[model samples]
Structure formats: C-alpha cells, structure tokens
Target: MNLNATLFAQLVVFFILAWFTMKFVWPPIMKALDERATKIAEGLAAAERGRQSLDLASKHSAETLREGKEKVAEVIAQAEKRALQIIEDAKLQAKSEADKVVAGAKAEIEQEAARVKESLRERVAELAVAGAEKILRREVDVKAHADMLAAIKQDL
Candidate 1:
C-alpha cells in the first residue's frame, strides 16, 4: 500500500465517524444533560419556595402570640378594675350598716331614759306621803286627803 493513500483514507473515515456521532449519539446525550439541568433548577426553586413559606409561617406565629399576650393583659386589667369596684361597694355597704346600727342604739337609749324619769317621779311622791304620816304620828286617811295629797305631790 502507498502511505499517502492510506493516510487520506483514514482521514475520510475519521470525519464520517465524527459526523455520525454528532448527529445521533451526541444529540441524545445533550438532551439528557439539558433535562437533568432543568430538573435541578426546578428542585432548587421549590426549595427556595419552601424556605419562604417557613419564614412566613414563623412571622405569623409570632404575631399571633403577641396578640394573645395583649388580650391577656387587657383581661387582667379589667379584672383588677372590677375587683376595686367590688371592694368599694362592700365598704359602702358596711358603712351604711354601721350607721343603721348606731341609729337603732340611740333610739333604744332614749326610750330607756324616758321610762327611768317616770319611775323616779312615782317614788318621790310615795316618800313624801310616808314622811307626812311619820310627822303626825297618826294614820292619815289617804282617801279623804286625796285632793290635798295630790296638790302636795304636784308641788314636790
């Protein structure tokens, strides 16, 4: 064989093989690489979306907890105000009851004083009659001297 002819033939065959590989085998391999790249991009996008959703959820949870704390503080403040109101009402009621008891006690003292004054007057009249009988040293007819005795009792 001639070396120049053999080298030329080998160059032709190499070009044909390269063209066939580019047309058939290389296209499928490139298509598979593009599909894999697209799938990886989509997966990365999905992961980023999940991270954003988690951040949003955490923010919402914090907001809800703050609102609950505010509600609890408001409730506690209202309860304190109500407790103060109840205490004031109880004090007022107790004062009113004390005033009523004092008034009743004063009324009872006045009634007892009136009864004592009437009894003292009756005792004074009896003592005057006994002293008169002792001075005369005789039994005085109380019925006959009733008018004079009544006048003496009135003077006393």
Candidate 2:
C-alpha cells in the first residue's frame, strides 16, 4: 500500500466522524449544559431573594421593637403622672382634715372660756350681796357705806 493513499483515506474517515459527532452528539450536550447553567442562575437568583427577605424581616423586627419601647415609655410616663396626682390628692385631703381638727379645737376653747366667765360673774354677785348686808348691820357712816357699795359694784 502507498503511504500517501493510506493517509488520505484516514483523513476522509476523520472528517466524516467529526461531522457526525458535531451534528448528532454536540447539540444535546450543549443543550444539557445550557439547561444546567440556567438552573444554576435561577438558584442563585432565589438565594439573593431570600437574603433580601431576611434583611427586610430584620429591619421590620427592629422597627417593631422601637415602637414597643416607645409604647412602654408612654405607659411609664402616664403611670408617673397618675402617681403624682394621687399624692397631691392625698396631701390635700390631709390638709383639709387638719383644718377641720383645728376648727373643732378652737370651738371647744371658746366654749370653755365662756363657761369660766359665767362662773366668775356669779361669784362676784354673791360677794356684793354679802358686803351690802354687813354694811347695813354695822350702822357705818352714810358716806363710808356708800363708798363701800360703790367698790362692790365696781367688782361686780
């Protein structure tokens, strides 16, 4: 056999086999690779979406926590105000009670003072009657007796 002829035959067979592989085998392999690449791209996109959703949830939770803190502060402030109001009310009530007690004490003191004055007045009237009887029984001088009665009247 001639070497040139054998080489030429082998070259023709190689071209036909390459053509068959390109037409029948390469397209399916390329399609499968393209489908796999598309699936990978979709998976990456879904992962990115999930990450964004997680970030949004974190931000929402932080905002909700801030709102809850504000509400708690508001409740605490209201409670403090209510407590102050209750204390003020108690103070006013205590002051009012003290005033009532003072007024009652004053009234009692005035009644006691009036009773003492009445007793003093009765004692003075009895002394005047006794002095007048002694002056009449002793027959003292008219001017002196009259002066004694005047002194007793002044005491009364």
Candidate achieving the largest lDDT: 1
The per-residue C-alpha lDDT of model 2 at residue 141 equals 60
TM-score of each: 0.60, 0.50
Model 2 stretches astray by more than 4 angstroms: 1-43, 116-156
lDDT of each residue in 89-156, candidate 1, tens digit only: 99999999999998899888888887786677667888877777677546677787889989977875
lDDT of each: 0.89, 0.86
**Number of clashes recorded per candidate:** 0, 0
lDDT tens readout by residue for model 2, 35-87:
99999999999999999999999999999999999999999999999999999
lDDT score, candidate 2: 0.86
Instruction: Give Cα distance to truth, residue 135, candidate 2, Å.
Output: 11
